[model samples]
Target chain A: MMVTGKKHEAAAAPSGAKLDLSHVSKVFRGGQGVHDISLSLEPEMIHGLIGANGSGKSTLLSLIAGQRFADSGLITYGGDHVNEHAAALSQICLVKTYERSWENYSLKEIFKFASIFYPHWDEQLASELMDKFQLKGSKNYQQLSRGGQSMTGIIKGLASRAPLTLLDEPVIGLDASMREIFYRTLLEDYSNNPRTFVVTTHLIEEAENLFERMVYIKRGRVAFQGPVEDFAANAVYASGPATVLEKLLGDVRVLHSERLGGKLLLALEDLSGPAERRMLQDQGVELSPVPLQKLFVYLTLRDAENSQGGGNR
Target chain B: MSYRSLMKFHLKDYRRGALILLSIFVCVDTALVLLMKFLPAWDMGTADNIFSINRNIMSIFMIISMIVTVAITFPLMSSFSVTRRNFYVSSLLALLAFCITAALAETAVYLIGRAVLPSIGLPVDVDRPILLSAYVFMLTLLDVSVATFLIGACYYRFKVITGTLLAIVYFGAVSLISQMFPSMEYMENFALFSSDPAMLEPGTTLLAWGIIALCAGAGWLIYRRTDIRM
Candidate 1:
């Protein structure tokens, strides 16, 4: 098993335009919360948080948004702790899945109420996005379809223009076309008005182009956090004759391996060294890019396997 | 935004419903008054006058409204990123305003009866406005809001069964305390004892404030640790 990165508190590092969570942990009654998670999100970039279901992605976002307080550790945005500080919390807007609490409110009314708190709420942009999404202003939130509910939340997240915006499953029930539109709208709006956005979604391939960085959370800890290219490059999916692949792989750590039609496919990590590349070339082994979705599955499966092994002991 | 703006937004939810309910209540009360005026020969002796009419019915409805509003508003405000402290402060002020409005409305109804009843030969012999004690009305409203808000906060923090159990125990304890202390009985009869000299005594006020403080403390303790489950 690959060693997980240690969460360190480095003051004066990643200075300015960053949201910092240092050794934050929030444990619920049934032991179903995030643990000792530390992450630093820089501004004006789109970041993706990918993990299996129940892997604490939402919990981390909740802690950052002040929806839940950490059991320990600190979260700071723009140099102010967000747990109880309104000024600091105002910097982030979190858009969650459909909530029945909004049933009594019309979309326009919800916007009117929320605009009061968010200093950078863009009324025109919200109106335009609502119109584009075909979301009726007069309909109560409960009256909308599932995709419409997602649209309302997306509109809020985008229009708030908070320095830090977190969207949890923003496209849960969106159709293919709506999902495409959302991606385009997000990228265009993000470019026009630069701000930080952290999105967690299951459809990684669809949204991978919009992400500059990806954080893979397994169980309650971060398995990986780095640039998207670096994450894709951190592991290689090699396929060739089983004998040649084994020779090429040598001592490289294999996260996942399988045989397909008399050939071997292995997810090899830490294979970026020149020596390993030369060996693979000499053996004529094929190297495929590990997409974010497969990377997430492989990492989470590895974690689950390790956890089960520990439990059996 | 300012606290006043949030208070207005929170209070706005009750506007239409309150208007409709109060309108129906006033219409029915006025119809009753008119019927009494027309039937001058029918003297139902020992009947309570309008100035002394019990408002427990309205108070019960007020208690339910407080609970429902708090239950609904907590999550809604949290979704809007309003802090728990801000919500509590705004709700406190809004509840106070609601109590004052209720008190004034009750007083108006009695004053209207006093003006109309005597001219129609229906005499009110009470020493003062018998059913419109602002102190009693305010205290009762405050207690209802605090107790119901606390129960709603409990529900926000726990599951339905646990929340329901906590709510029953909380309300039962309040009931037990009110029953055990004779002074606390004033919560049910403040208007009845409005003409008594003991109405201004400090004991009831102290007890009422003490309960309010306890409720506030308990509510803050629950709210600070709660996760906003969206």
Candidate 2:
């Protein structure tokens, strides 16, 4: 399915500037980075870039934002090469956990710099966010607590209102309440302005509700990319008697399986249609939808097992 | 327009640091000149006059300012989506502005000292304050360009320790070469301390400009391809 997003008024490109990455690869000296990634982000939608630690999510975001050039293939936004076109770059903002040189600058100063570069920067929203986050503009960045720093990055990402905003681990040090505030603020802003936001976080369940679509990267390759509901729909957990489940799921791709006191639970991928689920249910087997976090874990775990020359049952 | 904004941003980055350095320069120079005038028995050595002292101080200040500005502003600018080409151009402009401002301020101080010291029964040796300031501007510009290139190249490619060691080795080799070849001593003197306008050779000025261009070009080559890390 083609990912489509809402039109952004302040975007430099024409209304339908979907972010396109084709055959993209970035290999580091240590041989760990994204590989052969081809994906298109629909405009004006909140996308969850979910991945395990060192799964190349950050690298992919950097490549998209044009902060780092790709070693091969192409990344384009609005029909322009993002890395080579200033206008395309101006419309994208990638907010990291910490800006290395921002420590010495006051939050106000940082905002001023952002306002200068980002054509659609919302100063009023930035001020409101500062108040909401309980961050003083006069406070230098280094003086802020870790949560405060995270809040600062959040404010910048939300207020810049760029056409394509990528936030990497945006809620790293935030408390539960602040994280909720961040989510709400992000949703509210998107409601009002309607731009694309790609957020990468480990707090999958907490942020799952906010993502319209999800892209999961495992071992530097895209494992899944679709609507959140579809991602959940792609797999299911079936529980039944160990012997019966083993016999029934012999031909299926079982991502994970565990036996507990004569009962066996298996994560099964590509279990086609309602007939298969009904068949399992008729056989005294219980079928339940797998949660997103669990699905991610099971998927990655399967990849790990496969790579290690082991079968996934 | 982006270039202009970047230039303004860089100038702002250097403003506070430059002010602090200027204040220190003024305070120390003022205290020493006053002591020389008040205490006749305290011999102000021939090479230890206020002008010479201020020149050395300004050079140090400019070097520090250049290194700090590049180190701090490059990442900051990159974070704001400023292009590498714009950043390099704006940085050079800001550094040039700083050099000119410092040169003018140093000239004013020299003029004031020249006027006051004679009335206070102290002999002033320096002349042609305007020419001196122009030379100072050129020299400071060259120094800062070189410093900016070295700092940027080091941070982007070589780590700090390796860059520092490389710098030390290069300077050490130059020092050894100068010591071995007495004729090359003039070039060292021309580069470092050509205070007298009459001794300022056109070739020296041209060489300084050429070196500045080389540094700027080499710096851009390194910077344009550099990936802005975090």
Candidate 3:
């Protein structure tokens, strides 16, 4: 149905998005989900929502989708509170990991059903996806394999082409080839449409290059967020003997360390000068670039370690 | 969310589930009918008055359908997005469909019985007007009431198996307590149709439906706030 005082196409096929999630803490009665979190996402970019299990990544996503409400704050999308954006849920395609079966309905039926709310829903894309995915109309949903079922869900979210697309672990079950297909299709689609795609996953390394910005969620809060390259560049790894490395790096930040025989692999932060490099070299230290994955690991883990260590650093 | 659209889409799902369920219903009902016709040893202690016997047979089929519909609805409820704003509204619609479907299925049996029975004034005990409207309302009541706890419990708690078991255990336990307390006997009033399927008085019918609507609204509010972790 056409919403009041809004253009039909503009409402559905929104070019840019403004997503604001304020002090949104989801506290279960039993103390389980998200806690005191706040985030504002920029539009027309691939924003990665990453966190370890129980860090409230999924809870935050649910709040954005209005599948679950925040106990204490607001989730505003396109200048409207999420609940008020009931009209927008149709335009926001949420691909949940555990959602199984649209209940034996044909692939066509599934698209048709969802298409009611999404005025900008690409029917051609839906048909193309079914062909690309090779999903048969006659087969029951339960008859498909685990990967196949996931593919169907992925198709729904992608084909819906919602302006604010949230994909929560969409490629977990698929093989490398299928994941590549997903990534390529996602990039291609985003380029063509220029819509906001918020993807939450543990597989950061695979798509690190694709990310424009990253939201590293640690304990339901943004521990670190910036451009993916900048995020990876924030921490660098250097190596040498444990004592020499410690002395050379004295008060500087070190996210992780391991002594291989007599050599220490030290994940370093705040590189300064040639003198510092020489000092580390004289100590037989070797510096290496920390991959985005390692940077993520260090950022997430080091924060927890510091939170526990009483800020002695 | 567009409830009408969601409902239409859901009914598509319901068709598959319904077909499987109806196949089970038809096969069982058809088998029972065939058994009554051909199988002498399988007969219940049914009286020989053809009209009365046919009505009783139809009653047996209606009760079976009611049980099956209730049993599977729990699973469908569990699979749905129970923590959303759509939960209660969807539940009400599902219940409405369930009740209407059951009543219609039951009505079919009544018609069949009327056709098969010996010469009697209109064959079946159902009043056309009463069966038509009252079934819609009664189905609404049964569905919304049962859905209140079912939808709430399923969304808040994980595991469909555990959720269903818990709902049954809780219902049975609460029902027993209500039996013991005089003031709590009102809990049983919703099930008045089950006790006497001979339609309802207008006041009680309105009261039952009003309670269902109130419960449904309350359930919707609860669902919105409830944390959907899964």
Tell me the spans in candidate 2 whose CA falls farther than 4 Å from its real position: A1-15, A247-252, A258-260, A273-275, A301-313, B37-41, B45-48, B119-121, B160-198
Question: Ignoring the other chain, what TM-score does chain B have in each prediction?
Answer: 0.81, 0.81, 0.56
| lDDT tens per residue, model 1, A1-313 | 1111221111112323788899999887788778899889888799999888888999899889998889999998988888767777767788988766788888988888777777677777788888889998899999898999999999989877777889999999999998988999899877766788999998888888999999988778887898988877867888888887765444436778888877889887667787877777677678877876787677667667767787311
What tens-digit string does per-residue lDDT give for candidate 2 at B1-230? Answer: 36766766776777778889789877987887789888988765432255657766766676666666567677787787777777778878877777777777777776787787778887766455466445545564455546556655676666788678756754665467458743333334322444554445444455456556766777787777677775
**Which tens-of-lDDT digit does each residue in A1-313 have in candidate 3?**
2233333354356557688877888776566678777778898889988887767787788778776667788888787776625565555667777654355455566566656555566666667777877778666666777777778777877766778888887877788888888888888877777888888887889987678999877766777777877766646688767778756444547777777887778787656566887777776777778888877777667666766786634
Q: Looking at model 1 chain A, which ten-residue stretch has the lowest summed lDDT?
A: A3-12
Report every candidate's CA lDDT.
0.76, 0.76, 0.61
Off by over 4 Å in 1: A1-16, A246-260, A304-313, B23-54, B113-132, B158-183, B188-204
Candidate 1 clashing pairs, residues 3+ apart or interchain: none
| TM-scores for the candidates | 0.85, 0.89, 0.76
The docking quality of candidate 3, as DockQ, is: 0.25
- Number of the predicted model whose DockQ against the real structure is largest: 2
Better by DockQ, candidate 3 or 1: 1
